[model samples]
Target: MKPIFPAIRLRDKGNWLAGRDGIVMAFFIHRDHSEVGPAIWRSIQAYLRAIPPGSLNWYTSADGDMVPLDDEGWEHNRHVVIERIGGGSRTVELRESPSEAGSYQVEYYGRRLDSPFHDAPATTLSFTFPTEYLVEHGAVRLRSLALELARELPLNFGYASFALVSTQGSWASADWDITEALLARYAGLDAPRAMRLSSDLGTRALAPAWLTFLGQPLLGQLGGIDALRDALPFPEVSLLPMDGDRVLVTLDEWPDPIDTRTKPIPPQYRALAQRMEPFLFQYEGEALLPYQQDMNRWIRRFL
Candidate 1:
């Protein structure tokens, strides 16, 4: 069988980075932790080790303690070169460190295993081992390794808001093709169309909506919705506009009619709202305020 990994597609990007080619991902750890623990490093090392032996290689600084800056002037927190490819291809770089506020940060450049013979493929490593592993019968990467480590570590891992990124060294970038057909299969919801509203506003609104629903990974949230979708007669996910305290759940148009504060959520939207309550509450808490603010700005800019 082909290597079964979960490949993430692009959701949105800023004007500058959208044009570039790359993969972006982020992990948000609990605020209380001052530094990453041993387990995270061990997990990282193990994940790196799982790659095909000769295909995977990394670098260590000469001083061996402090990191060495590369051509781009980025300093790897661990002072370790995760991997160094030999060819003239674009150099891949990874920078990781904790912020003054305390959350861990990471940015990778030109880091992805490209197809031995494909470019601009819709999917890359969807959390799976390389394709060679399936037929070669040797050591291979596994999704379970990452998933297990994730369960043990205290961090949130998922798609990063990619910009004009160097995800694929030369040309292979994984971007979401958000056609209604793809949306129906991936999100179990009808894709929003440029109907009923002025083209510009509708175009803006729909992009952010799709990112929230399909770009970010919602392992736990999806688990709950999967059960709900199986048990109840509701779509897996939906988007609404929050007007003051009022949230409009169904949108057949742009600039939906604003309701007065006295209005209650209609019966049809109640189930979808209830199903989405946990994720809403979890994301709306105080801890993520700054992140939420930045995300809101991105949406507004993209929309």
Candidate 2:
């Protein structure tokens, strides 16, 4: 079957990390204890070569020399640093899998940035298909050509919260939408204050605004170290402070969306869709782009 990525143009949100302006890196990882070896490198080169000449490009040298798919330039190392030129200014590399652990990691940028912009590095592409195309297709497609490189491998995808993500000086100055449930629970504190409680604390209703984690067996290391598990809060029915202002409410995916009145994020079985103020990005499907460009726009649009 044909793949959906290259055939479909996915709008990238890019990363919203503020202040430190640097290149957004794209990482492709796999499990099953596969190591980056000569065979794999050759496979990658061949794969790239098969595509239309200028559609994608990878480099093995700083001068931007292409890794030859032919017998001429086939050399492998425990870890290989390949700079991907066409798809944004991202550095792609693969390391030897550890002895006992099958660990895979992916970092995605948010919305698609039109390349060759005024940015210093002139990020060309949005790291659209950074990793080997097959690896990016992942387990969903049974006949993914790139899968031949690393068979029997599973992946976990997510990206970091951009450094520019510090929002709201305090609950007083902060404007969070308050949910009816939260109004009932944190009755004493007003809506603004309740918003702080949900996010700062590990409330089940709370989800991270910076990074998103997807793929089977969501790992804490991906989205965040302290993200709430798939389990719902003790009481199935609890009011969450979605907006810290006027008792507005939204709930994350959990026991059921029945009473919440909001649909859960499909398939993933988790929803962090509530627009947290100061949130500049939406970490969806493992891509960490700027889901929302303007803070105020994001709040008004989602809320």
Candidate 3:
């Protein structure tokens, strides 16, 4: 069978990379780094174990240069992750070579609880996996991994969905045209802003994705899982109760990169968006560029 989304690589002009299908899973933890750091580490370990050995061959160093994930470099990166998790603000990034498409990637941003810079503080952990892994191992395996990670972390809001992953931020990259075009064509392809959302998301939820994880006060605010189920009555939607008073809402059997150019947004996604509208986070600033305007519009696609 043909893949839903074929792998894409534009190494010369844009240095872009995307797999046949891409999965972007992110969690926002309202707790301070000191409290959630260990959990974050464990989640990272879980991710590493899930992927092939040596899949991650590079990591971003303190100087922002990509360094080989050699023994010494790996140990140093580990120290940085643990040390930053223990005390101050932290940003940990590990990934395969940017030259390769369908590479495994992990990005984490941990903020200090008492930092004056962040009005809405939350630690954000994001993971990117090529859907080839899912196709080979099965969707159930990925779902189980997501559940395990969610169970371990104290997250306020989290989501897993099909996305267009690139080496750089999609909004600010030179290949914004390609990114924008793909996003316009595919309603299910998410443009994740983990770094931006970490500082602003706080306890609020973003738009719903393929798999939406609701925890704590957010779930309570929505009147719990029962209310959600009642609101989203589509047969394609499933609400699974999780540990820590969290719930994982699955939108469909597999993520659909619905071609919006030819079809309407999936009803299940639209319904969940409407149900979560009151609590969804909207982009606040004025969009100065066409790409920015497109992003803001995408944020409100379901509304």
Candidate 4:
């Protein structure tokens, strides 16, 4: 009857906040905002429909602030999101409540291929949900929802897994020590940097998660599904093909936040990482965190 992943809470500015052990479903698209705006909106709508009503009741504003999701705020947010997605703005972010115990959050970073500021940009959309929802609705429902969103968006790469979810701004400054501690103990928990990845991920694959979505050029480079299957011979891993030449690689029946203090990294995950190392994205330049020596080493943890 224990929880699948550890529940984490941390204090920031004298306020206790939920910091880790949540589910994150994210996708990266290589298309420009003008080309993929409508589809992203559709996928967002689908996510809203799948979750409970009022699960999201607040959103971040233009000034990088949180606004109540009132009647007027809702209408205005819709307009802003549409405008940003249509290339009216460079990035789009929406959140429920970062200070709340467990909040639902969504974020999108668009790409302007012609802009000097954007270097190898690939638009990214990330959706976060508390583990309580998964416990209530079951893993099948969560996987079905991920599949549904995948079909709606033309994603080059995507994943769903156990993650350390927090407000990026505060968590980085206040909770990183705690984060490093938790990560040391739990090898399966992913600490995602969606905004940074949006700018740098490009067409490369990331480390494999519980549910890894692979599409296009990268999938072709790997010699398609048959080759991938031959490389990853684990029986627990399931490869489900989807429309649009994409494949959803499910590592196991459920996401495991393996406590490495007591057990080693799961073999299935290591196998997938080994098969994907060549095509995986390498983090260059400065370390993402002050304490971390090399981001690439972190990306290759499964190896």
User: What TM-score do all the candidates reach, one by one?
Assistant: 0.31, 0.26, 0.89, 0.90
Q: For model 4, give the 10-residue run with minimal summed lDDT.
A: 84-93
Winner on TM-score (1 vs 3): 3
Please provide, for model 4 over 191-261, each residue's C-alpha lDDT reduced to its tens digit, 9 standing for 90 to 100: 77788778778888888998999998778888899998998888788999999899999988877887887
Q: Write the residue-wise lDDT of candidate 2 on 113-138 in tens digits.
A: 33342121111101112223334343
Worst 10 residues of 1 by lDDT: 194-203
- After superposition, the stretches of candidate 1 with alpha carbons farther than 4 Å from their true spots are 1-27, 54-143, 156-303
Model 1 per-residue lDDT tens digits across residues 201-278: 200122222112211223244343345344335342333322221121221111111122323423323453344443
- The deviation in Å at residue 275 for candidate 3 is 1.3
The Cα RMSD in angstroms, rounded to one decimal, for candidate 1 relative to the true structure is 17.1
- Pairing residues by index, what is the TM-score of model 1? 0.31
True-vs-predicted CA distance for residue 262, candidate 1, Å: 42
Please state the error at residue 180 of candidate 2 in Å: 36
Clashes of 1: 17
